[model samples]
Target chain A: MSLISLALYIFEALAGAAALGILLVRNVFHAALLLIVCLISLAGVFVIYNAEFIAVTQILVYAGGVLVLIVFGIMLSSRIAGKPLVVTNQYVLPASLAGILSAGILIKLFSEQPFAQQPGALPGNPMNQTGIALMRDYVLPFEIAGILLLIALIGAAVTASSFYSKKQ
Target chain B: MEHTLILSSILFAAGLMTVIVKRNAIMVLIGIELMLNAANLNLVFFNRNNPALSGHFFALFVIVVAVCEAAVGLAIVLRVYKYYQTSIPDQLTELKD
Candidate 1:
């Protein structure tokens, strides 16, 4: 096998293992940390696929932004409860069966399909191309995403704030 | 190509299991994030050869949506925790009390 393929394999294995660890870990904090490992390894996988921009965004948005939000959620809720958040599993047999069955079906379908694997390389820097595409062809959607983000920010703030709490 | 697909499917399955099994609402949100990441991985991998960079742009938009989802979801979870004094979904059943 080529070096790139070898690296891909290693990253894939790490990501899969970390994802499994997230599933098996009982502590919410530890699970979030394991999810960081899984996400970073997947970012490496994105790099192997020549999606450097997505890899960086994966690290920035996912590992940096979303994870911090999740950790904050954990801490806030736990403080209210006056205890560490301990995740519990329910319907283990059914959930595992569902997971394995879905995985098997998807793998079988993907393996059966014939994909023309083109090792086509982008001409310019991917980030540059992405910027141009966003500006030119995808400006509408980009603006919509901006609006959506604004609404979400306001909504989160309003929802989380103690504006209408009952007198306790 | 196929390897990436399989990996994404596995990730999706794991996320599904997590959503089903975990009692904590935040953990369920984490699982949803995993599933979204799996979809993003598939998008980037499939469109790697395309010149239009559609998948990359789509993944960017997906990340935006994910951020929004995480923020709003966490806020709702916190609100629920504050009012109910519990974050477990099963423990909260009344729509309005």
Candidate 2:
């Protein structure tokens, strides 16, 4: 009913559709592109919730960082430029059934849960507050996340380099 | 809030289907990304409702973790593709004896 929820709905639709595109498209390149769309729309969804900081991070980390990494992996691992990457659909029956059952359970749980509290007013943006908290109270975890990311970078480099070493 | 939850549920389901049906290693990673995004959506949605800032903070951490996961996962995928000459997960059965 409200304009924000309307925007929310639109972004959600865009994201969901793009997610489906990631699955349905046979070309890994197209699927990677679809993933960028999905990730961007999800960033929009984060914006709709007034979490501007998270939204920007979503774009920065996901669209800018992760999706590019995926594309790089696709390019380096094989030549998918001309060929469409199709796969056999032998596992669809079980997975689809699992997907369906989980969806049903989630929908039923959502219907039954009573939402009594009115949604809060949208704050301007929590960027300042979140920054302060991250530096002050959450500084330890913040530092640890940096550590984790650094470790991941080194580990990934080592793993990928092992392949090249084997080749040489 | 409920609408957001339901939308995220659909996203998660789609991710599940992607993981299940797609045999391409990259596709499975994409599905995993979708699922992670769905959880992040819910966390942000609830943070909107309550303003505790916990959800917002955790969402950021989740993003960080996702970045790490993608890097490591892609490296592993690339390594496997190099050795196996294919990205199809079902076909890689050398160690399954």
Top-scoring candidate (TM-score): 1
Chain A TM-score values for every predicted structure, listed in order: 0.92, 0.87
**TM-score, cand. 2 vs. native:** 0.91
What docking grade does candidate 1 earn? medium
- Where does the lowest 10-residue lDDT sum fall in candidate 2 chain A? A80-89
The lDDT of each candidate is 0.89, 0.84
| DockQ versus reference, model 1 | 0.80
**Model 2: per-residue Cα lDDT over A1-168, one tens digit each:** 998778878888888789877767777888899999988988988887778899999999899999899999888865633355666555878988988888788878887987655456555446777888889989999999999999999999999887557675
Give the winner by DockQ.
Answer: 1
Top model by lDDT, which number?
1
